[model samples]
Target: MAKLHIAMYPWYSFGHMIPYVHLANELAARGHRISIFVSKKAHSKLQSHNLHPHLITFITITIPKVDGLPEGTETGHDVPMELNHLLCDAMLLTRQQVEEILTADKPNFVFHDLAFWIPQVTKKLGIKSVCFLVISATCMASGIKPFREVTDDKPLTEEELTTPPPGYPSATVVLTLDEIMSLLGASDFSGMTKLHEGFTTSMSDCDVLAIRSCTELEGKFCDYIQAHYKKPLLLTGHVLPEESESKLEQRWADWLQGFEPGSVLYCAFGSQYVLEKDQFQELVLGFELTGLPFFIALKPPVGCTNIEEALPEGLEERVKGRGVVHGGWVQQTLFLSHPSVGCFVSHCGFGSMWESLVSDKQIVLVPHLGDQIINTRLLSTDLKVAVEVKREKNRWFSKESLNEAIKSVMDKDSEVAILLKKNHLELREKLIKPGFSSGYVDRFVQSLEELAN
Candidate 1:
C-alpha cells in the first residue's frame, strides 16, 4: 500500500477534536502521515494529552482567531454573544489558511468536522473531504430529515414520527408538544436549525461520512442513514483506548478505599452542558436524597458569573464527606473506569453515554436538550442499559424524579438493572480485546488505503 498523508480539521471544542485526534493517532500508528487543522486552543489541549512520539510527527495547521475570544473560552459552550458573526468570519479565514496548508503539504485526503466550512473549502481544492459525525448517527438521521422536508412554520406534525419511521425498524421515539416547548424555552431552536442545515450539506457533499458510535448500540439507525444517503457510513464503535488496569485501579483505590463496592454514584454531565440555578439545585438534592456516596464534577456555566452561589441552600454542608463537588476538568474516562463507581448520572450526550457504556456503568439519564433526548431513548428503550428520569411540566428533570431514578439504578434486586450491568461488562470486554480494540478504526484506515489504490 502507498503511504497515506491525511489531514484532519477538528472543531475547537475538546469533545469534537479529541476523538478525531485519537483516530488520527490510530491511523498514524498504521504508518499514515497525519496533519491536524485546528484552532490554537485545541492544539494546546492536544499537546497536553502528550501524544506518543510517532503521533507527534503529525503536522498541525492553526486557524487564527477572528476576534479575541478569551484564552480558555474556546469550546462551543464558550460561544461569545456575537457567535454567529464571528463563526462565519472565522470560517472564511480558516478556509484560506487550510488551502495554504493543503497546497504546500498535499495530503492524500482530508478529514473535517461538521462545524466550519470544510466541505465547501475542500471541494474547491478538489480534495476528498470525509466528515466524521461526532454524535450519534441515529439522532443525526432523525433530526436532519425535518430540515430536508420542513420548509416553513409548518413543522413536523405528530403523525409523521409517531409510528416507526418508514426507513427504520425501531419505533420512533416521539416528543410531545410539551417537550418541544420545554426544549425551545432553554435552547436556541432557530440556531439549531441553522446548524443542521450546515450539517446536512456537509454529510451530503462529503466523500465519506462516519460516526463515533457502535453498531451493536445503533445498528438499525446506522443502516437507515446509509440507505437514505447512499453514502459510505462508518461506525467506529466508541474509539477509546483502555488505560492500564494497574493505573486505573490505583486511581479508583485512592477515591474508593473506604467506600463500598457499587455503593458510590458518579455524576458528571460531560465537558459542555451547564446547569441553570434551579437545575443545579435539583441535581444537588437528588444526589443527597439517593442516600449513597457520590462524586460530582461541576462546570461553572459558560461565562463563570456567580457559580458558587448557584448551589442549593446549605447543600454543600449536607453532603460534605459523603460527596464531592469538583470544578474544571477531571480525568473523567479514568474516573468512569474505576471499580467503585456504581452508576452514572449523565446529560445523555453521545460522548458521555459511550464512555459510560465502555466503563461498564449503568446510566441515569437526565437529558437537557439537543439530541440528548434521542440518545436517552436509545439507552433506555433500545439498549435497555439505562432508565430515564421523569420530567416536570416543563419537561425538565425535577429533584423528585432524579431522586427516584438514582434509587432505581442502585436497587440491588432490580432484575433489569442487574442484567444491564452484566451486559455492559460483556460489551466492555468485547471492545478491549485485540481484534476489537481497533476493529472499527482499522477498517476505516483500510478503506482509505483501498481508495488510494
Candidate 2:
C-alpha cells in the first residue's frame, strides 16, 4: 500500500484520545504518517502512548475559553460532569482552528469523534473525513439508529429510553428504570449540541465511518449501523497495542507479590467517573466481606477529599491488611497481568471492557454511563463471559451485591463460575488470534485509501 497521511481528532477525554493514539501507532507502524490533534494538556499526557513518535505527530489543539470553565480548563479532567458542557462548547469553538489546520496541512484523511462539523471542513478541503468512534458498535446501533435523527434539545423520558430505539437489533439491550433516570440527569451536552446530534451528524455527513470494534464481537450491531448509514463503515478491531511496555510500579508489584496466584481482586473505575460516597464505602466494605485480598484504586467519592476519609467507620481497620483503597492512578495492565489478581471489577468503559476480555481475570461490571451500560449488558448477557453487579432501585450497588458478583466468579468450582471462565477463555482466544486485530486495521486503512482516492 502507498504511504497514507491521516489526521486524528479525538475528543479531549483520555478515554477517547488513548484509543486514537493506538490507531495512530498501528498506522504509523505500517509506514503511514499520522497527525493527532488534542489540547496541549491532553497532548502532554498522551505523549507516552505514541509508540512511533517519528512517524506520528501530536498537534496541540487550542481550546477556546468559555465562561463556566476555569481560565485554562481545556479537558474534562479539570471539571465535574455537570460542568462538562462548557468544555464541550469550548471544543466546538475550535471549528475555525480545525478548519485552518486541515486546509493547510491537507492530510489524506481526518478521523474524528464528536466534532460534527469536521465533515463539512474536510469535504471542502477534499479530505476523507472518517468519524472514528471509540465506543462500541452496540452503543452506536442502539443509541444512534437507522431511523430519524433525534434533535439535540429534546429530553428523553423514562418510557422512551427503557426500550431500545427504533430498529435496534435486539431485545436483550433494554435499559433499567435506574439507567433511564441517570440518563435524564446526564443527558444535556450543553448549549452547543447533544451527543446524539454530534454522533448522528458526524456519522451521516462523514466520508467514512469507523468504529473501534469488530464484527466478531458486535456483528449484528455493526451490520445494522452500516446498512442504515449507507456509508463505508470500517471496524478497527479494538485498535490496541499488542503489549504494554510500561512496568508495574514497584509499590504495586511488592504488594501484589504477597498474595497467592489468582487470589486477589483488583477493582477500578476509569479516571472520569467516581462513585458516590455511600457506594464507594459499600464497594470497599464488600471487598472486606470477601475475606480475600484486594487492591482498589479509585478517585475520592462525592463529598470526600480522599479514599480514607470516606471509608465506613471501623471498616478500614477491620480490612487493613487485606484491602487497599488507593486514591491515585495505577497501571491497570500490570495489575491485570499479575498472577495474583484473579478477579477484576470494572466500570465497563470501552477501554476497560477490552482489557477485561483479553485477560484471564474473572469479570464483574458496575457501569455508570450510557455506553458503559450497553457494554456491560453485552459482556454479561450475550457473551456470558462475565456477570454484572445487581443495582438497587435507587441505582446504587450494595456491599452484598458486590460481594455476590465477586463470589459467583471467584468460586471456580461452581457451575456459573466455571461456565464464565470457559466462555471467557474461548472468546479471548478467538478475538486475539494471530493477525485478527492487525488484519482489521489493514482493511480499515485500505477502506480509507479507497475513500481517499
Candidate 3:
C-alpha cells in the first residue's frame, strides 16, 4: 500500500471537529498524510489536544462576519442558541477560501462534514469527495427520507415532519412536533432549512458516505442507509480517543475521592446546552433527593455570575460533602472513567453517549435538544442500556421524575438496574473486541486509497 494525502473539513463544532481529528490520527498512524481545515477559533480549540504534528497539518480558515454572529464565535457550540445559524452562514462564506487551499494543495481526496458546497468545488477540482456524518446512523437514516422528499419550495408537512420517514424501522424513533419546532425555533427556522439543503446537496454529489457508527451497535440502521441511498456507506466505528492519564484538578479530584468506588453519579451536559434557572433548580433538588454523592459541571445560567447564584439558596450547603458543583470546563472523559463514578446523568450528546458506552457507566439520559432526543430514544428504547428521565406530557422532566429515573438506575439490586448493567458490560466487551473500531478505519482508509489511485 502507498501513503496517501487526504484533506478533511468538519463542521465547526467541537463535537464534529474532535471526531474528524480522531479519524485523522487513525489514518496518520497508518502512515498517511492529512490536512485538517478549520476556522481560526476552532484551530485554537484543537490545539489543546495532542495531534500528530508530522502526519497531520492544521489549516485555519477565517469565518466571515455575519449578522447575529458575535465577532469571535466560530462554532455552533461557542455562540448563543439563536445565533447558531449565523455560524452556519459564516461557514458557508468560507467556501471560496476552502476551494483556494484545496486547489493549491491538490489533495487526492477530500472528506467533509455538513459543508454542502465542498462537493461542487471538489468536483471542479477533480478531487474525490466523501460526505462524513458526525452523528449517529439512526439519526442519519431517519433523515434520508425527509431529505429526499422535502424541498425548499415544498416544505415537509406537519405530519411528515412528525412521522418516521418511510422505510425507517418500525421501532424507529421520531422527534415530537414540539421538539422539532423547538429545534427550528431556536435558530429562527432557517437553520433547519439550510441543514436540509446541505444534506441534500452533499449526499447527491459525494462519491461516498461515511458515518461515525459501528455495525455492532447500529447494523440495521447502517444497512437501511446503504440500501436507501444506493451508495457505498462506510461505518467508521465509534472512534473513541485513548484514555487520558491526567487527573482532574485538585479540588474536583479530592471531592470525588471521598465517594466509594462506583457510588457517585456524574452529571454533565455537553458544553453547548444552557439550562434555565428554574430547570437548574429542579436538577439541584433532584440530586438532593438521590442522597448519593454526585458532581455536576454546568455553565452558570444567563444573568447569574456563578453556579451558586443560579442554584437554589443554600442548596450546595444542604447537599454538602455529597455534591460538588463545578462551573466551566470539566475533564469529562476522565470523570466518566473514574473509579468512584457509578452513573452518568447526561444530555445524551453523541460524544457523551459514546464516552459512557466506552466507560460502561450506568446512564440516566435527559436529552435537551437536537438529535439528542433521538439518541436518547435509541439508547433507552432500542438498546435498553440506558434509562431516560421521564418527561411530563412530553416536555421537560420534573425534579421528582428525574429523581425516580436516577434512583432506578443506581439501585444495584433492582432488576432494571441489573439489566442495564448487563447491557452496558456486553456493549463494552463488543467495543473492545480486537480491531473492532480499527478494522472499520482501516477499511475506510483502503477505500480512500483506492479513490486516490
Candidate 4:
C-alpha cells in the first residue's frame, strides 16, 4: 500500500462529523495516513469515540475569536444565526490561520465539508482538494446548477421557482419559492457572510468532488454532474455499519420488549432543528391524541428549559410508560431498525432519512431548513416511499395534520404504507451488496491507492 496522507475538515455537527469520521476510518483501513482537522467542540466526540486506534489521527484546529464570534463557539451551528453570519462574513480573515496549518505539513489531498473557506484554502496550498458533499448528489447538482446561473448574473426571477430544471424527472428535482429565497438570501441569509461567499468560490475551483452517496440512489444526478463539470465524481454510499439483523433484534428486545410490534412511532429530528414553543406544544398534544406507544429521541433546542415541563398539558403523564423521552444522543441506527418501530417521524435530514430508508421503515417527513425540504420532497413525491406533512404559513405545522400523517403511515393495511416498507427493504439490500454503494466505497479506495502512487 502507498503511504498517503489525507486531511478532512468537517461541519460542526454530529451528523456531518460522524460521516466524515467514517470515511476517514475507511481510508485509514487502506493503509493511508489520515488527519481530521476539527473544531474544539467537535474534538470531544472524536476523542470519546477513540477512533485513532482504528488507524486515523485527529488534528484539532482552534478558530480564534474574530469578527464578533463568541470565544467558545467555533462552528456556525454552535451559536445563534446572527453570530454565525458574523463569523462567516469574516471568512477572509481566517485565511492566515488556514495558511499556517497548510504550510506545516501539506497532505496529498484535503477533503472539506461544504462550510467555511475550504476551496480558498486549498487553492492557496497548491494541493488537490475534494469537497465531500455529505448530502445526496441530487441536491448538490441542484445547488450547483442554480449557482452557475446566479454567477452568470442571470438571477432566476421569483417566477422560476415552479419551473422544473430541464433533463430531470418531472418535479423530481425542483425547488420551491421559499427554498429559492433561502438559497438566494432574500430574507437575510442567516448563514451567509463574506466567508460563505469566499467558500462558495472555492468550491467552484476545487480539483475534485465526492459525495457520501452512491449512484444507485442518484444515478441521474451523478451522471449530470460528471458530464457538466467534467470532474471525477465519487460516491461512497451512505458509509454506515451493516448491523446484523440478530444484533438489532437483541437490542430492540432490551428497549422495546413490552411495546407492541409496529405500534410505536419513532420520532427524532436529528441534531439540528429547533421547535418553537408553540410548535413543540402542538406536537406533544398530537402525539397524545394519537394514543399510540411512542419514543422520542430529541436533542432539544440548545437552550430550552426543563424539557418535560415544556410539553403540552398532561402529555408527559398520559404517555408515561408507553413513551420514552431522550434528551441526549442514542444509537439511532439500531433504534430505527428495531421491529417495534412502526414508522419514523423525522426532520428529514439526510442522516435521519438514511437511517429510516435503509431500515425499510415507513417515514413521516417533517422538514425544516437547508436541504431538508428537498430530501423530504424526494422521499414523498419522487421516491413515493414516505408521507409528508404540509407546512403551515411557511413556519409551523399543526397538531391535527401531524397526527393524521402519523396514523396514515403507521396503518399497515394502507397500500402506500405497505409498499414503502417493501421498496425500502429492496433498496437497502441493493445498497449493501456488491456492484452498488458498498462497491462504490471499494472503488473510491482503489482510486486513492492509485492517487498515492
lDDT scores of the candidates, listed in order = 0.69, 0.84, 0.82, 0.69
lDDT (tens digit, per residue) of candidate 1 on 88-135? 345456677777888777677787755446766666777777878777
Candidate 4: segments with Cα more than 4 A from true spot: 81-83, 90-92, 115-126, 146-156, 160-170, 182-186, 189-200, 242-255, 301-303, 434-438
> For model 3, how does the per-residue alpha-carbon lDDT over 1-453 read when each residue is reduced to its tens digit?
779888998887787898899988888888999999987778877875536789899998888889877767778777765566667788789988999999899988899867888888988998988888877888777776553344569766767667777778746477776777554325434566666567657876888888999888889888988887788888788888776778787887888888799999899998867788888888888998889998888988777888878888888779877987878898999888789999999998899988888886899999887678878888898888999998888477888998999999889999999999899899889998888878888887887777677
lDDT of 2 by residue, 346-379 (tens): 9999999999998999999998865788899998
Stretches of candidate 3 off by over 4 Å are 146-155, 170-172, 182-189
Error of 2 at 151 (Å): 10
After aligning candidate 3 to the native by TM-score, how far in Å is the CA of 253 from where it should be?
3.7
lDDT of 4: 0.69
* Collision count for each candidate, in order: 0, 0, 0, 1
Instruction: Pull out the clashing pairs in model 3.
Output: none
Better of 1 and 4 by lDDT: 1
As for model 3, its CA RMSD to the true structure in angstroms is: 2.3
lDDT of 2: 0.84
Candidate 1 structure, TM-score to reference: 0.86
